[model samples]
Target: MSLLEIEDLRVTFATEAGPVEAVRGVSFSLSRERLGIVGESGSGKTMTGRSVLRLIRAPGRIEARRMSFDGIDLARIPEREMRALRGRRIAMVMQDPKYSLNPVMRVGRQLTEGLRLRDGMSARAARAKALEALEAVQIRDPERVLEAYPHELSGGMGQRVMIAMMLIPEPDLLIADEPTSALDVTVQAEVLRILDGLVRERGMGLMFISHDLNLVSRFCDRVLVMYRGRIVEEIEANRLSQAQHPYTRGLLNCLPTIGGPRQPLPTLTRDAAWLE
Candidate 1:
């Protein structure tokens, strides 16, 4: 059975103009594999990830014909049960760690809090686990990092620390929403490497949300190209070069070629028919 199954998922927000459909009739299934959701901003990739965890607030509502994680029916589950599932069974690594981490709290305390509360571990044990998780993400000087405040860390270090905190609970699935977007190219590679290694070793399902088509194609097993709040194309990562959808092709063509002739990046031309 699939680790996650979402069918006819729709997210809507109440606006002065009318109800805006942010995610429209999306359907997909994932197992213990990487599934990439890629699109331009406001295409609803992030909303889709948030909806999986029931993170949508008032004035915004999620409706779906079916949504399940493992054998649990997420659509029908109680909030209490869903809370237990979150962070313990399914965790999300947000796009920006600066916003995710608490400025006043020390990094080690934040990491240990979840372990102690969720796993019923002693403070000493939780700290040990926190340090181990830091090392697992290839963070050098885990002890030093643990003691530092979130504001003291660089963008890359902050991101790694976020990843470490999320992984400390040993979740079955991870929703990484552009986890490397705020980092340098080199740091991006390092973060991806750590995520790739963890997914492989742990056999965890990953819902990787990103705008970078090339990165998704390289890192994911399957790709879903969303446009205007709907999935316009679904392609195997290995077959991304042969994507048939115009939106997917347009995105791919926009990527600059290294050491190639200089040219203006292609602008994406939208078709109204795609919304239907």
Candidate 2:
């Protein structure tokens, strides 16, 4: 069964120029597997992920025929009820940890805040859980990390802490929006390994939003190619090279291969018909 489902999801913003649709009529379902959404900036990949959690606010609005998670209707749920589900059931890791983590707060306080406030965990127990979560992500010095502030850690360490924070709740579905975009190749691989192991062991669904086609093809089970706010094609990750859509083909062709060519990478040609 699907852990999350969406049909005709639309995200719009009120602009002086009129209404701008950031995510237009996109739909998909996710089981307990890694599903990747790949697209260039402005293709609505991040918007779609945020819409599932009802994170859009103010000038932005979300509308959908159906959006549900674990048999619960996300669209119809009260904000109070949604708040209860946010971390405990569905968690999201933002692209940058510097902005996401409170700069003034210690890592331990941030990690244990949700548990103590929402789950009513004792301070001692929450600290222990936080340490375990850090260890799971391969942070060798968990105690030092818990005491340090966000700025005290490196990009890779901060990202790992974000993952650990989300995993502490043992959420059923995790939406990671460019979680490793800022990390170096070595750290990126380590983060992916940690995420893969956690998802497999816990049987949690993952919506991995990224623009790296090569990485998505290798890491995810299924791939959704988005173009101009719509899914242009869906294909098995292993067979992405054989995708039938011209947009998907164009994207694959644009990837720069090592030792393949010395010339500049080819530019992606856009087609208006692909938006239809």
Candidate 3:
């Protein structure tokens, strides 16, 4: 059986104008493999990830014919149980480190929280586990990083710290929402490589959300292209060049070629029916 399954999932947010449908009729199954969700902003990739964890706020609604993780019905699971599942079974690495990290807390304290709660290790053991996790993410100065405040770290450092916190639990499924969107290209590559390696090595299911189609195609085994909250196309990663949907095709054409002749890229045209 798949690790996670989502069927006809829809989410609506209350607005002054009216209720806005953020996700519509999205369905997919995840195995111990990398699955990419790519879409422009407001296309519901983030919302879908949040909904699976039952993290949606009031006035926002989620509806799915069925949503399950490892044969357990997520929709039927109690919030308390869901809380236990979160960070322990299925973990999420949010988009930005600046907003995710606590300024007042030391990085080591935060990493140890994951180890303590998820692994039930002793305080001293948690501290050691935190250092090990920090080292696993290639942080050379794990001791210093543990003692330093969040504000003391660079963007890349903070992100690696976030990665360590998320992975310290050895979760079976990972949901990373543009985890490298804030870093430099080199740092971004490093973070992605670390995550990809962890997923492959541990045989964990990954729900990789991003706007960069090329990167997703290269890193993920399967691709799901979402537009205006609905999944418009699903394709094997290597065959992304042959995507059938117009939205997917447009997204590919929109990427600036590395050495190709300079030309004004075509803008993506929207179709009202595509959202229906």
Candidate 4:
């Protein structure tokens, strides 16, 4: 069964000029697989993911004909019910770990607090669970990490901690929004490996949101390209280079070739009526 189902989902912001449609009729389903959503800023990729969790702020309104996860209707669920569903059944890993982690609290307490909230775990049980989560994310000296403050950890280490905290709930679906964007290349690769491992081992559904086309093509099973508030193309990861849309083709060509001829890359030109 599909772990998530979204149909005709739309999000609009009440701007001063008028209603700005951020997401227009975007829909997709995910199972035990990695689904990549890629686009430049203002392309509606992140908004779609946020709308799924009803995370859109007050000025932004989300409307969907149907939105579901695990056969439960998310759009119809109450705020309290949605809260219950969020951390326990579905989890999100935001772009920056520094912003997500509390600076004042010790890492161990903050990490275990997630488990306590969703699962009502005892302090002892939460600690054990936190340790296990840290181990799964390949953090060395999990006990030491637990005792350190967020400021004491490196960017990679902080991201690993965030992943551990989110995974402690054993959520069925994981939405990672540009999870490695703030890190260096090496750290990005490491973070992806940890995410890949968890998704593969647990057979969990993953919605990986990013603008890194090359990485998305390699790591995900299927890739969805967004432009101007719509999905412009969808293709298997292996077939990304063969995508038919002009936008998709341009994106693939724009990627810098490693150790190959070094030259200025051509930028993408937009067309407003291509989808028509």
CA lDDT of each prediction against the hidden true structure = 0.94, 0.94, 0.91, 0.91
Q: Which whole-number lDDT from 0 to 100 does residue 56 have in model 4?
A: 90
> Which sections of candidate 2 miss by over 4 Å?
none
Model 1 bad stretches (over 4 Å): none
Roughly what TM-score does model 1 have, to 2 decimal places?
A: 0.98
Tell me the tens digit of each residue's lDDT in model 2 across 1-276: 699999999999999999999999999999999999999999999999999889999799999999989999999999999998888899999889899999999999999999999889999999999999999999999999999999999999999999999999999999999999999999999999999999999999999999998899999999999988999999999998899998888888887787988888887787789889
RMSD of 2: 1.0
TM-scores of the models, in the order given = 0.98, 0.98, 0.96, 0.96
Clashing pairs in 3: none
lDDT (C-alpha) at residue 223 in model 3: 95
What is the per-residue lDDT of model 4 for residues 126-245, given as tens digits with 9 covering 90 to 100?
Answer: 999889999999998999999999999999999999999888878999999999999999999999999999999999899999999999999999999999889988999999878999
Could you tell me how far off, in angstroms, the CA of residue 92 lies in candidate 3 after the best superposition? 0.5
The alpha-carbon deviation from the true structure for residue 129 of candidate 1, after best TM-score superposition, in angstroms, is 0.7
Winner on lDDT (1 vs 3): 1
